[model samples]
Target: MKVLAIASAGGHWIQLLRLMPAFEQHEIIFASTRQSFSETVSSYKFYAVPDANRWNKFKLIYMGAAISRLVLAVKPDIVVTTGAAPGLMGLLAGKLFGAKTIWVDSIANVEKLSLSGRLALLFADRTYTQWEGLATPKVHYHGNVLS
Candidate 1:
């Protein structure tokens, strides 16, 4: 399997890395907003994308375009993320191109699914919340990366 594992910086990136073992059997491609993160996954492919948020409309568009390009270029069999907006862009792009997509809500969002997670529910093939209580019929809880 070819997996595109992506996230934003900070906690989102950390959580995505924690899921690395799950991709060990496959070819994994990593992506994030920080180019420096390439050092962390030096053995695999890494892409640096623009960072965006709900507050930044123009940057969000750029991020979506960048992510879309990456997905088209890589054509991953699956796209998984612990997200912010960048990861959501990946999920959507992956979906549009026939790749299965997963959205793993961050452990920090204990009370609710993050905004990106909610948006992802519409497109991702599967959606999960780190907190079990947050799981619904559509959102699943299958443990957490932080654990």
Candidate 2:
């Protein structure tokens, strides 16, 4: 399976990386908003995308376009993210391309899902929360990066 793993920098990126072992048998492509993260994913195919947030509408649009193009080019079988905004863009693009999408809400958001996580629930094929209490009929809890 071809898997595209995407996330923003900092904790989001760390959370995504923690799940790397789960995709070890698959061909994985990594993406992050910060170029510095390239070093961490040096062993795998990686792409750098623009950092964006709800406060920056224009950048978000640009990121959406870039992610869309990347998703089309890679044509991954699955797209997964531990997100902020960039992850949302990837998930949206993945869904549009008919790739199965998984959204793993950041572990930091123990009380509630982040805004991007909630948005992902609208389209992501599978939505997960690290905290079991946060799981609902739609969102699931099957373990976490910390574990």
lDDT score for residue 104 of model 1: 94
Model 2 regions more than 4 Å off = none
Q: Which ten-residue region of model 2 has the weakest summed lDDT? A: 51-60
> How would you encode candidate 1's per-residue C-alpha lDDT over 1-147 as one tens digit per residue?
999999999999999999999889999999999999999999999999999898989988988998999999999999999998999999999999999999999999989999898899888999999998999999999998897
lDDT of 1: 0.95
| Residue 10 miss distance in model 1 (angstroms) | 0.3
Residue ranges of candidate 1 with Cα displaced over 4 Å: none
The weakest ten consecutive residues by lDDT in model 1 span 54-63
Q: What is the per-residue lDDT of model 2 for residues 1-147, given as tens digits with 9 covering 90 to 100?
A: 999999998998999999999999999999999888889988999999988788988988999999999999999999999998999999999999999999999888989999999999999999999999999999999988976
For candidate 2, the TM-score is 0.97
Residue 142 local lDDT, model 1: 90
